[model samples]
Target: MNPVTAYRFITANQFAVVGASTDRSKYGNRVLRWYQAHELPVIPVNHKEATVESVPAIASIEEIDDPANAAISIITPPKVTLGVLKKAKELGIQKIWLQPGAEDKAVLDYAREAGLDIIAGGPCILVQGPSLLTHRANL
Candidate 1:
């Protein structure tokens, strides 16, 4: 999809980072920061109790208080991506952004089979998020 289409899909609703972490060095951690910088409502989904960029990181999607109209960023390993996708589907989440290295052909096929609108193997959230040159120009 084009950047505008992807941006629209992503910003249409609240979002959650499926593997977000508190570790400053991690991509998940940085992504959460980027989300917050954009003033987006983002929940961090991490099994650990550590908070990412001051946002509470929960263990699973089911733990989110309100998941309605939410999209998920799957930043976990390929081996665990399918499980996350299944959980997202179970929670009625239609949109997903699978970060690079977080998805494989099997995961993509499974997501398609499950009828999900997914953006996979694309640029990271940092590139496509509100920090874009387009977004900056509009500021």
Candidate 2:
């Protein structure tokens, strides 16, 4: 999807960052921290970790109370990401942003077939997020 549409889609929904990490240098941690820094509401989704970036991590997308209203930003490996996409589809999540290195042809194809509004092919949230602030404030 276009960056503008993707940005709007994310800001319009409840956001979540999957693949969160305790390590400060990882992309997962950076994504989580970015949302916090922007003062945006975002949950960290991590099965391995109990807490990430100081917030309790959700074990799965199934754990989100309102899956239909949420958008997930995936920063995991391609294998893990494919699995999360399947689960997210089952949970009624229609929007997803697969960060660089977390997406591959199979996953992209699956997401397309599922009719999800996806932001993939390298538009990182770390860059797009700040721009959304002005858009969000107008909402």
Candidate 3:
């Protein structure tokens, strides 16, 4: 994961939490809560739910009002990650954060081939967020 890229991503005007869940026990829900706790503007994407944490959730990336420059944090399985990437590519969304356990070798390869700027593997957002938030404040 590239620290610079991650910073750029988190600092975007808007962010999307793909695969966000209502189940607080799940990482998907946890990720969504982190953004909310920080008072960030985030869209929750969940095909199965109309709302997550009381926020309206879009079922897919295609529903985003502004996808060309949007940043997204994915918390889905590898297969779903790939599909999200494909849609994101078509929408011109370039900044993607593949949360831990959300990616596999194939997902990584496809992101690369599609020219996505992704932060995958270790250092989940919860780890870097506090510092990153402070960094943003300082900036």
Candidate 4:
């Protein structure tokens, strides 16, 4: 639940938003916009869509060229979140940020077992991300 981890997670070579949606009312869209608004290198992960927020979307985590060098923010159902974690683990993507509804006992347990650098049961990135950026600006 460390905010520092969230900061480090996004400060990666690339950032992906899993379940990034076209629906503006959803948390998925909101989270994706957070990254975009901050002007970070971001890719949207949405299997059913060709693009999200005008950015080309990848179907899965494995589609990224360098999984080990990226961080992901997930906004899927708890069960689907577990599957995403499994894929991420198999691909060596360690930095994982599970948005509030994306985590459950099973998902957290697997993430723990997989030795993932995870942020769960903490503040959503939307809440802390701006402050973190402000801190970086001040630095």
Strongest candidate by lDDT: 4
Could you tell me the TM-score of candidate 4?
Answer: 0.92
lDDT score, candidate 4, position 103: 92
| Weakest ten-residue segment in model 2 by summed lDDT | 4-13
- TM-score of candidate 2 on Cα atoms, chains taken together: 0.92
Poorest 10 consecutive residues by lDDT, candidate 3: 130-139
Model 2, range 1-139, lDDT digits (tens) per residue?
5866575565655778998888999999999998888787789998888888788889998898888888888999999999999998889887788888999889989888988778899668898767667777777
- Candidate 1 structure, TM-score to reference: 0.85
**Whole-model alpha-carbon lDDT for candidate 2:** 0.84
Clashes of 1: 0
Which parts of model 3 have CA positions greater than 4 angstroms off? none
Report backbone clashes per prediction: 0, 0, 0, 0
When 2 and 4 are scored with lDDT, the better candidate is 4
Better of 1 and 2 by TM-score: 2
Clashing pairs in 2: none
Report, for every candidate in turn, its global Cα lDDT versus the true structure. 0.78, 0.84, 0.88, 0.89
Q: Model 2: C-alpha RMSD to truth? A: 1.5
Poorest lDDT segment (10 consecutive residues) of candidate 4: 130-139
